[model samples]
Target: MATARHARPKELENASLEEIMDRYVARYADRRADWAAFEDAKIEGYKRAQHRFIGAGGSGKHNDVSAIPAGNFTLSIMYVPPGQGNAAHTHEVEEVFFVLQGHLDVFVQDEDGRKISKRLGPWECISCPAGVIHGYDNNSLEPVYFQVMLGRGKPETMGYADDDLYKRRDEHLKAVS
Candidate 1:
């Protein structure tokens, strides 16, 4: 009478404890720093790096074999330098940012482009709903480190506010390795 949700996967069910741990555990030192910018970040002011830990974490690197397999969501550590940030964009699923260090000026916008900004320091967080345009800036003197998560294990590429960027959103996909 056990349901699939409660059943152990065949791959893990027969594996040794060490094998299970090897497949599930992701060490921080082994993570790769991927700076594969999204379409909008190709602009002069927007740039950042993503250290993938689980799934692609919305960077569209779904083929990254080194990352721990994601179940329901994706996770990554974002590094944003001073005066740099992401442009307004939206995804098919909700996105969350939990600031781990430095200050990030985050904002969310309505359909008409009306936006509200807030300064988030360490331990602060924000959840941007699906289809809402949101972004962040590192106005502080130092770089900002933050954890990012997306609702889906492999969400679609984000939709940029700018027509050009939106049109080229999938360009980053081809460049991802």
Candidate 2:
């Protein structure tokens, strides 16, 4: 007697074409910016928002869910207004930033507090190693846009390199609370 062939799962077999298509496509208009992740206008810098398309980055917020589920990495776009950017922070996984528009000044600081900065124009990219404290700044008058990809799907909260900045952030949170 011949055995029956294995059948596909019911969910997969019953899924509509549109459902499958939607899972693979993500439009820019459909994305929303999460402003709560970075700056609050209290600090001199650190005013940026992230648009997630692959996964919720290290922001520790589930607000942004990408159309494509992240397996080994997370992808997101960051919008940094002129003169504003993220503060120096370290991650356990590798983080890369690809400049899409305007100019960005990427900087990394060593444990001894020495910092090295680089300028990245459109189509430029920078990859920061794990546990390195790095940050970005848009010194130009025009706004800067960049794509950020972390090695891990679910990254941990960023560890600020500047003790003063961390303390100030904590104090600000306390005041608001």
Candidate 3:
């Protein structure tokens, strides 16, 4: 006896944004419908802490999530502990930062190595261009909550000069400690 062959369903073949969003929401709802699994995920998300200690430079903590490819952006949620800062660094791509809390002093170096600095407070945002040497210092007594979005570029491609070392090791140590 010959077996009957069944036809396969076609793919979405270009769904609209509304359709995609509706499907995504429905999928999340289904995943969250499982009480135990949802709760476990929430707990795990809260418990996974990541920190980078200061060596010759500075230290801070970060909580990063795998980024989506929708807008060619990488998003990170980071917390700079009070009195901690990053070593002078720069990136080869444009980046945007939104300060959700606390204050930060950003020092930037231009093409000729001339340094310029500015202070950022809560709700402040800055757009940093590519190839500019830059780094941040936490000037507040509390941890700063911030989100950073980077464009597609190897951050290491930007040139850096460790001019901030003197600021950290010499002038700021007594003040910070």
Backbone clashes in model 3: 0
- After aligning candidate 1 to the native by TM-score, how far in Å is the CA of 73 from where it should be? 0.2
Looking at model 3, the pairs that clash are none
Q: Write the per-residue lDDT of candidate 2 for residues 1-177, one digit (tens) a residue.
A: 966498645655777769868875778799887666642334668778878888766664444445366668888889999989877888899999999999999999988989999999999999999998898899999999899998997776666777765554433233323
Instruction: Work out the TM-score per prediction.
Output: 0.91, 0.80, 0.51
**Which candidate has the top score in TM-score?**
1
Off-target runs (Cα >4 Å) in candidate 1 are 1-5
Report the C-alpha lDDT of model 1 over 73-155, residue by residue, as the tens digit: 99999989899999889989999999999999999988788999999999999999998899999989999999999999988
- Say which prediction, candidate 1 or candidate 2, comes out ahead on lDDT: 1
Q: What is the lDDT of residue 27 in candidate 3?
A: 22
Clashes of each: 0, 0, 0
Winner of 1 and 2 under TM-score: 1
Rank candidates by TM-score, best first.
1, 2, 3
Error of 3 at 172 (Å): 27
In model 3, how large is the Cα lDDT of residue 167? 34
Best by lDDT: 1
RMSD of each: 2.9, 5.3, 14.2
